[model samples]
Target: MSFLQRLTTGLTASKIGTDRFGNTYYESRKSWLGYGRKRRFVLYAGEPDPTTVPPEWHCWLHHVTDAPLSEQKRYPWQREHQRNLTGTAQAYRPPGHDYAGARRAPTAGDYEAWTPGG
Candidate 1:
């Protein structure tokens, strides 16, 4: 949709908040087309990965929390947000992963197959 279309539908929308990942949230308390559900929209960052959303914003996005994270007090101990790394070069790969082509041979100690009542 063009900027004008989005702006028109959400003319009453107030900026909700933004996360560190560059995702922006907007919400309109008013109902749209008599649907009676609050209108909420998200302008996702670069590639639109769902995992990029933080817990606080995630709550608001799903209507779990009506108050935005920006309106609440967050502690410093909370860990930084991270997006899903699967399928990327940064993805985790075990030592025996097929793509890595490096498998470790199991030794006697590693072969401990359990037998019932043995």
Candidate 2:
């Protein structure tokens, strides 16, 4: 965040809540005339990564709901939230992907090759 933004936010933003990721959520104390709604934002715990924000907080930040939904279910049936891992080693790699280095097994019913006028 820029110095100006930091200054403005410090002076005008109200702390709403903090996510499990340690990111803090905030809203402007007063709404802007043009927007008709208070500005909302997150101060990341470390590096500013949009992926770090969970779905509930994401919705709140975007004004999808007046308030963030309660904590997500923690039961065994519910899968935990994971940030995007596209560029990391822990990211998912399909069986035939170069990183996996394994070709997919052929299926029993293979399609015949197309030939022109044969």
Clashes of each: 0, 0
Q: For candidate 2, lDDT tens digit of each residue in 1-118?
A: 6799778878999889999889999999999899999999999988888988988899999999999888777898876667788999999998878888877767799678999998
Which clashing pairs does model 2 show? Answer: none
Worst 10 residues of 2 by lDDT: 73-82
In Å, residue 73's CA in model 2 sits off its true spot by 3.7
Instruction: Give candidate 2 regions above 4 Å deviation.
Output: 1-5, 111-118
TM-scores for every predicted model: 0.65, 0.76
Cα lDDT of model 1 by residue, 1-118, tens digit: 4699577746678777778788888887687788667877777868878888777788888888877666346689866566678899888888788877779667676977889999
